[model samples]
Target: MLNAIDAIRIFSGDFQETKTFFVEAVGFEIGFEDEGVCVFDLAGTKLILEEVDLSEPEAAGMVGRFTGVSFATDDIKSTYKELSAKGVHFEGKPETEEWGGAMAHFKDPAGNVFTLVQYPPQN
Candidate 1:
C-alpha cells in the first residue's frame, strides 16, 4: 500500500545550472550532493536532481517539462512577486482556481515547470 513520498527526481543534462537554480533562485537547501546527483531538502521529503547524458534521446526528453510539483505557500501573490524579483521567470500572474486556491507556474533553468500554490482557507 502506498503511504508517503520520500523523494522526487528531476533529470537534467545541465546539473550545475539546475542545482544553482534550486539553491539560489528557488531557495532550496542542499541536503546532499555527489558527482552526478544533488538532493534538496524540502522539509522531510527530498527533491533530487539526477544528471543525465543529453546524447541519449530518452534521457534528454526528461528535461524541460511540467514537473507536476506544486509548492504550498500562505500567499501566492507575495511568493510569486518575491521569486520574480529574484529573476525567476513565471508563466504569468497568479490566478484563482475554481477551488478558490491561487496558483502560479515558474520554470527552472532546465525549463522544468513547477507550481506555487496557495490553498483556500480551512473551515
Candidate 2:
C-alpha cells in the first residue's frame, strides 16, 4: 500500500512568478530549482511547480486548475490574517464546513487553488 504522498506537481504557465509567490507569499522554503521547475518543502511533502505549455492538449486543461492542496493549521483565523498581510489574496474569511472544520481558500500566482483548514478539537 502507498504510505504517503512523496510530492505534488502543479503546472504553471508563468514559472518564475509562481515560484516567487510560493517562496515569498506562501512562506514555503525552496528545496530545489532548475530551468523550468522549482521544488518547495511543504511541511515535509514536496510541492513541485513545473512549467507547462498551456497550448498543448494534455496540459491545456490543467491551467488554473484547483489543486486541492489543503494545509492544516491549528489556528485558521490567525493563519488567514498572517497570510493576507503578506499580500496573499484569499477567497474570503474562514468558514465552517459540513465536516465541522474551518477552512479558507486561496490561489497561487498561476491560479492553482489551495486551502487552509483547522479541524475541530477532539474530546
Candidate 3:
C-alpha cells in the first residue's frame, strides 16, 4: 500500500524564477536544480518544477497550467509576516479557514497557487 505522496510536479515556463519563488518566498528548501528542472522539499514531500517552452511555434496555442500546493505551518500569521517582509505578496491576509485552521494563500511567479495553514491549537 502507498504510505504517502512522495513528490508532486508543477509545470513552469521559467524554472529558475519559479524555484526562487518557492525557495525564498514560500520558504521551501531547494534540494536540486539541473538542466531545466528544479526541486524543492516540503516537510515530507518534494515539489518538482519542470521547464516547458511555450514560445516555440510547436508549443504555441497550448494552454499553460499551474499547480496548487498547500503547506502546513505552526503559526500562519508569523509565517505570512516573515514572507511578506521578505517581499512575498499574499493573495490575502490570513483568515480563519473552514478546515479549522488559519490560512494564507498566494501565488508563485509561475502562477502556481499555494497556501500556508496553521491548524487550530489543540485543547
Candidate 4:
C-alpha cells in the first residue's frame, strides 16, 4: 500500500538556476546533488529538481505551470513580504480564503508557480 510520498520532482529547463532559487531564495536545504539532479530537504518529503531538455515535447510541458505544491507558513503576510523582497514574483498579495486560511502564489525562476499557505488556527 502507498503510505507516504518520499519525494516530489519538479522538472526544470535550467536546473542550476532553479536549484539556486530553491536554495538561496526559498531557503530549502540540499539533501543531495549531482550532475542533473538536486534534491532538497523539505519538512517531510524531498523536493527534487531534475534537469530536462525543454526542446523535447514531453519535457516542454512539464515546466512553467502551477505545481500544486504549497509551502506552509505561520504568517502569510510576512512570508509574502519577505519572499517578495527577495525578488520572488507573487501573483498578488496574500488573500484570506472562505475557510479562514490564507495563501499567496509565487513563481520560481523556472516559472513554476507554488503557494505559501497559512492555515487558520485550530479550535
Candidate 5:
C-alpha cells in the first residue's frame, strides 16, 4: 500500500526570498537544504522548493506555486488572531462559509491560497 503524500514541492523564481517568507512569515522551520532544494517543516507537513535554471514561466508550463492547503482548527478566531499577530496576510476576515464552517483565507508569498476552517459546531 502507498502512504499519503507527505511533502509538496514547487520551483521558485527566488529560492532565498521564498525560503524567508516560508520561514519567517509562515511559521515553517528549516528542515534542510541542498544545491537545488530547500525543505521546510510546518508542524507535521513538509514543503520543498526547487531551483530551476530556465525562465519564460508562461511558456515553460510552470505553476507559480502549490495548490491551496487547508488546515482545521479547534478555534478559528484564536488561530486567526495568533497567525495574524505573527504577520500572516489574510485575504479576508473569517465568516460563516456556505460549506458550514467558520473560515478564513490567506495567500502565501508565492500566490498560493490557504484556508483555515473550523467545522460547524455540534451540540
Candidate 6:
C-alpha cells in the first residue's frame, strides 16, 4: 500500500549556508541536525539537507538542481512579501494561472529551485 511522502532530501555543497537559508530565510524549524545533515519539519513532512562532496561523482551533478518542492500558502501576495523581506529572492512577482491559482518561484542558496503555490478556494 502507498502512503504519504516521508521526507525530501536536498544535497548541498556548503552545509552551513544552505542550512541557514532553510532555517532562517525559509522559516523552517530544525527537527534535528548533525555534522553533515540537518532535518527540518515542513508541516508534517521532513525536509532533510545533507552536505555532499561535489567532487564525488554521485553528488557532483546533483547540486543546484530543481528540488520540485512546492509550498502551499493561503495568501500568495503576503507570503511573497514576507519571504522577500526575509532575504529570499523570487524570480518575479506572483502570477495567476489558468487553473485560477497564484504561484511564485524562488531558489535557495545552493541554487535549488522551489515554489510557493496558492490554490483557488472552493466555491
How does each model score on lDDT? 0.92, 0.89, 0.76, 0.91, 0.74, 0.92
| Candidate 3 segments exceeding 4 Å error | 56-66
Model 2: per-residue lDDT, tens digit, 62-93? 86878898999999999999999988989999
Per-residue lDDT of model 1, residues 63-112, tens digit only? 99999999999989889989998889999999999999999999998889
Task: Give TM-scores for every candidate, taking all chains together and pairing residue i with residue i.
Answer: 0.96, 0.92, 0.83, 0.96, 0.73, 0.95
Query: Which residue pairs clash within candidate 5?
Result: none
RMSD of 4: 0.8
Question: What is the per-residue lDDT of model 6 for residues 1-123, given as tens digits with 9 covering 90 to 100?
Answer: 868998999889999999999888989899999999999987779999999998899897888887788999999999999999999989999999999999999999888889899999999
Q: Show pairs that collide, candidate 3.
A: none
Which residue pairs collide, candidate 6?
none
After superposing candidate 6, which stretches have Cα over 4 Å from the reference?
Answer: none
| Predicted structure 6, TM vs. truth | 0.95
Residue 21 accuracy (lDDT) in model 3? 80
Q: What is the Cα-based lDDT of residue 90 in candidate 5? A: 87
lDDT tens digits, residue span 1-123, model 4: 998988988888998899888888888899999999999988779998999999999999999999998899998988888888888899999999999999989998889999999999999
- Once fitted onto the true fold, the runs of candidate 2 whose alpha carbons sit more than 4 angstroms away are none
Report lDDT (Cα) of residue 118, candidate 5. Answer: 94
* Alpha-carbon lDDT of model 6: 0.92
Please state the error at residue 123 of candidate 1 in Å.
Answer: 1.1
RMSD of 5: 2.9
User: How many residue pairs clash in model 4?
Assistant: 0
| Model 4 stretches with alpha carbons more than 4 Å out | none
User: How should the candidates be ordered by lDDT, best one leading?
Assistant: 1, 6, 4, 2, 3, 5
